[model samples]
Target: MEPTSSAPGQLQSVTRALSVLGCFRNGEDLGVSEIARRLDLPVSTTHRLLAALVEAGFLDKVDVSSRYRLGTALAEYGQIAYRQHRIHLAEPHLEELAAITGAKASVATRHGNDAVLLGTSSWREADGHELQGLRLPLHASALGKVLLAWAQAGEGELARLPYDSGTARSISGPAELGAELARTRERGYAFNDEELVSGFRTIGVPIGDEPGQVRFALGLRGPVELMIDERVPFFVDLAKVTARKIADVLR
Candidate 1:
């Protein structure tokens, strides 16, 4: 969903149209009515927005299903953005880390109140192929905590965290999260002990040169049984080494 209020001169139609595009997910098609229900707009208004997007190559209609999917234009733009981020340079290192850890490894950055996966390598069942571009709640993910902790997010951003989006193990509010972040900073890493998904654990390490200058983070995820306390130091050390490799490539 999109925010209702826009800047003084912003066009409502443009905002609505962008929101319609955001409704789509990886490998999924959605009909106009479903999109309308998600955005809580009238079907006619949603239809008009969808039509405009289709005309602009941001969406395509499947003739058989009468559903819309993200179009080639988005894929083109996504690829352009991906290249600009230089994430490809770190892909091999991520793959190496995954192989060594027998888990999933990824690079992520903060986007609003979420952590957006930029590149990922998974050698086990814990992480799926669809992880790239996936958005995880800032309060519920190890990558997110690393970003928030090392970047020193402003008060405004901290206040807007979607605490309810995470599981029971997630930090309850800003105060609690602030304490967790302090500990994460002191320990040189962050952890997600079933905060996002039960039976899963993840460790995140900063990818930048120092605390305040961190622009990205590296994450390692596996089942809790595989990520138990006894093996955490090994995983964290490997993750930090992988993070340094990624930071070198990013620089």
Candidate 2:
């Protein structure tokens, strides 16, 4: 078992397939042509990859359209991962928090330059807002800010962020984000005042006891009117309590 001649080819195929799935990070149903363009691969090669994924139940083709969307297999795997990470244990707490605060309550972890939602509960109607599995920009999301602040990330790491993305109200540069992180640390929470989405605000707090050892963050999000400045302190207090409860269970 010294080596296999086809190992490199198999590795390349696996990488390509993962890249294709990563292209759907925004939860969009994509056509073969669009996926190929994004990956800079030829149409024939992309089509083959799509066919394999469809056969494996990782993706499903729309009946009336050529677009492809995530399949049931991915959902099954997502649930398995959720339970493995003990995120499912926080679902009930998040739901209670959402009900009490009348906003979206979620737990997230830093994934590279983004914050990936692990669990979420919304008080409002299901208006096509799927917070779980969604990636929020670090500089533009309260959860991201809390994670970055508690982690005490270095300047080089901050400089590599996508500062130009997100809403116009987002932090424009690393220096600005550094100042914001300092404020977040001082306040013991992070605030996203329409930095990620227009007309919505979020408050975030660390879940763990130690400062730089924080591994997760809890967030409460709602519309600007509902999450008014006058109510922010109240919301932050409740969120901190809920985060502590969740952390206790995780430990």
Candidate 3:
């Protein structure tokens, strides 16, 4: 169907083009027919919109599968938005976490089923690692567990998210996850025993409201030996202290 005209002299093509772009929000690669069906438009209109998006570098045509996916433009815009929104809200605490622990500090948010790194404070002289826009397992990593524990703190939040045991130390399932999260609540910390990476342990604390809709985390990552042996308990205390201090600012 021809897109309904909104105003005199306004090309309806622009409106249809936007609809086609919106189809990628489901995080799936879309074929021409799928895009057309989703937008309730004719194939010809969908093809035209897709061609425009590809030409303008807003979408890309995958030759192997003949599918269309979001292009570099969206990634660039997303990075800009992450820095402007989440990172700006998180930076001050990140700096303090890094300073107090003398370890790398990072904050992350749930992006789809994965954890997206929002920001980090790393003093190069302090042997810290880079942490901008990295993705990690939802069931692993101090960063991921902090968010999970935050979710688990709520009455029914755990049911909303699915779990997988792809990692050697992932929670195995949601029931186990709920149990672990309960422990985190009581202990005021979470642990990643090489759950995300082999032989690398991290201690993390979730930062957010009671329901644990954790949009940010205060994480200290290091070698598993140091992370678990003499350092885990010490880091746990530091994380709790760090979390309370950051919460003060967040309020």
Candidate 1 vs candidate 2, lDDT winner: 2
Stretches off by above 4 angstroms in model 3 are 1-76, 83-86, 99-102, 123-133, 153-166, 212-214, 248-251
Candidate 2 stretches with Cα past 4 Å from truth are 123-133
Where does candidate 1 stray beyond 4 Å? 1-10, 128-133, 154-156
- Per-residue accuracy of model 3 over 1-251 as CA lDDT, tens digit each: 77656664355777777878778865679899988887788998788889988998889999999999999988888889975664666677677767766667776777766777666775544443532236676666667767877775453655565666446667666677778877877877877776766656677887755764557777777665556577678777777777666666655
Q: Give Cα-based local distance difference scores for all models.
A: 0.87, 0.90, 0.72
Global Cα lDDT for candidate 2: 0.90
CA shift of 117, model 1, Å: 0.4
lDDT of 2 at 118: 88
lDDT string, candidate 1, 1-251, tens digits: 87756754368788888888888855679998999999999999999889989998999999999999999998899999899989989999999988887889989988888898888884567564424348888889999999999988766777788799767898899888888988999999999998988778899999975758998999999888889999999999999888888888998
Q: List the residue pairs that clash in candidate 3.
A: 150-212
Question: Cα miss at 16, model 3 (Å)?
Answer: 14
Candidates 2 and 3, the one with greater TM-score: 2
Q: Candidate 1: TM-score? A: 0.91
